[model samples]
Target: MHVTELLKDWPCTVTGGRPRVQVTGVTERAANVGEGFLFVARKGKRQDGASYIEEAIQKGAVAIVVDRPSLSELPLNVPIITVPDCRKFLSYASARLAGNPSERLTVVAVTGTNGKTTVTHFIGQLLQGLGIRCAVIGTIGIFIEGRRMEYDCPEMTTLPAEYLHPLLAYCESRGVTHVILEASSIGLANSRLAHCEIDVGLLLNIGQDHYEEHGGREAYIAAKGRLLHQAHAIIVNQDDTQCRQMADASERPTLYFGAAAMLGYSTDLILQKLAIPGHYNRLNAIAAASALIALGYTVDDVADQISMLALPEGRLQRLEQDGVQVFIDYAHTPDALEAVLQTLSTICYGKLITVFGCGGERDKGKRAEMGELAVRYSSLVFITTDNPRNEDPVRIVRDIKEGFGGDCSTVEAVLDRKDAIRQAIFRAAPGDIVLIAGKGHEKYQQTATGVLPFSDVAEAEWALSEKTYEGKVEGGSR
Candidate 1:
């Protein structure tokens, strides 16, 4: 694509303007820039993206986009496109570069403190079941027609604007009719989904999370609200006052789903018989059902596909072969932990055991609250290590212990996460339910120094098998 035609819609002051420059790709990182690539510079949390400008230009960046005038003072002989907001500029320009594939595809974006992955997956499964070619993009990975696609971004829930637009274009090339995306608060705030043209935006529920990262609760919510603006239509959880408030202010068409809608409507069989357990999962169903209905499906159409809808990986996933009733979930936040614990308490026949830990450099305030909720619901609690990125793992554990009564017997701390899982699973008796919370699908734990290989599901399965083997040995000896 030519530079002039690609950025025709964008308001920019061009320096060293080369109207005939052909662009090959778009990126924010200097390391990713190559010949004919357009590098957009912006401010990041820890470092300014502009600092990498010299490196990008050196690596053969054909064009540059920057918001700040001072950052564009370099005498580089490239077509520099100066805009007011480069992040937003990146989104629009990348879409132009990718043939504006979002316009050709029906895009559905779902957001919340929790359930974004599950809800996004639910919508994709429903649409695919109904014979619509669909793709799902979220925390786990990007999927195109049921196959997980390998992209540059493995860390971001919502891919950055550069890679995101190209992914959308790829989806369109594959004949995908609908694309379901999981929008995180931070991603939305960063304008990752700026020019994608969302068809139906769904807000599952907003609970306490990422307080420190967003600087407070309101800012976090405001970041979430940005998705609703770009959406042509929106589906909101009426049970959440914050979602309701956002819906009330929206000028677009809206459909609401929650307890009120579920209880009031009689034909809602979609919520009752979900294969995935939990009231929160039921609410996730409602959110997905509402999105499907918004996209021109009936409650009956969704009801037919409801049984096939399952939770995403590590979401209250049960172990069938294991002797004890073991469930694993990615409930890192206080609200998520409380919900999962309460849900498990009802189905558990014997003692409920919970193993969880908080991440470092995250919302520390939720650590104690999660600990309190764990102790409140479980008969035995084992506090373990979560990805303590750049923070002391011991400190994180200590913070969690502060929430509950410091009875040494009631709750125990095992700093090593693997040992914690082993102790919890090995000690459980028959009819006991072991709920492993936090680090559900993640394969590694980010420590202060470096990332360590870990998976809660993997550790639980090993522990369960060992426990079963031990029982077999005793029985054989007897």
Candidate 2:
């Protein structure tokens, strides 16, 4: 694409030279700049892109977009355009460079504290079942045509604007009709999804999370709300008290989904029976399915497809051993933990056992709260390590124990996650349900220095098989 045509709609003040350069690509990072690349010198949280102006120029950048006026003082001969807000302009610049593929595809973005990944996967599965070529970008990984690329990064839950154009380009080339993505609070705060035109924006329930990064809960929610502005339709969980406030701010057509008995009118797509289990999962499914139904899919069509929708791995997943049941869930927040416990208490006719721990260097306020909730729901509570990255495991356990009233008898602290799981299993008698929370689908366990390979689901399966087989042999002898 020609540089002149691309910058024609960009909100920039041309300082030096006309927009005559032809552009090959758009890049924000200096290292990615190459021949004919239009380098965007924008300020970021940790580092300023303008600092790398000399480097980008050396790497064969054709133009530079900056928000500051001093960019004109540079001795470089490359054309420089000054925009009032380079971060805001970057969205359009990237879209213009990629030929605006978002305009062609039906983009459905799901944002909230939790359930973003599950909803994205659910919507992707539903769309695929309906014979549409759909792609998913979220915590689990990017899924293109039902195949996913498993890459793990600490902040990989959300899609970044840099990967936006290239992935959309790939989808457009493959003739994909729909794309579902998880838009995280941090992702929106950083202008990651600003460029993509959303067809339907679904906001699941919000809660306290990322306080360390967001500074507070309000800032985190405000970030998630940004997606609603660019959406064609907005869907939210009406049961959430704050959700009504978020919905009121939307100017587009809106709909609400929840399990509320008196919601003015019946839900367009009610979750009569959810195979995934948990009240929270049902709510997430209802909201996602309602969004699809509102997008023109029939209620019956969505309901039919949802029956076969398997729960995303490591989310309240169940295992049976010698009449004991174990559930593995990714409940890392207080609200999420509460929801999981309440759901388990409903179906669990026997004693409930919970094994959980908080990640180190995260929201420390939630540690005691998690412990309190775990003690409230389970007969036996085993506190253990969960990604204690660069933090002492013993200290993390001490904080968790604070919620248990210092009764070491009621709550046992096992720093080793494998030993924690085993102790919970051994303590469970027949008709007991053991819940392994925190690390659900994650494969690696992060310690103080490095990450050790581990899988919650795999370990649970192995333990269950061994216990069940041993029980069978003992029964035969009896």
Number of clashes recorded per candidate: 0, 0
Q: What is candidate 1's local distance difference test score?
A: 0.85
- TM-score of predicted structure 2: 0.88
- Poorest stretch of ten by lDDT in candidate 1: 469-478
List per-prediction Cα lDDT, in the order shown: 0.85, 0.81
**Model 1 per-residue lDDT tens digits across residues 149-225:** 78766577888888899888887888888999999998898888998889989888888888889999989989998
lDDT for predicted candidate 2 compared with the true structure: 0.81
- Among these predicted structures, which one has the highest lDDT? 1
TM-scores, one per candidate: 0.95, 0.88
Between which residue pairs do clashes occur in model 2?
none
lDDT of 2 by residue, 441-476 (tens): 899998866889998887776666555333264211
TM-score of candidate 1 against the unseen true structure: 0.95
Error of 2 at 275 (Å): 2.7
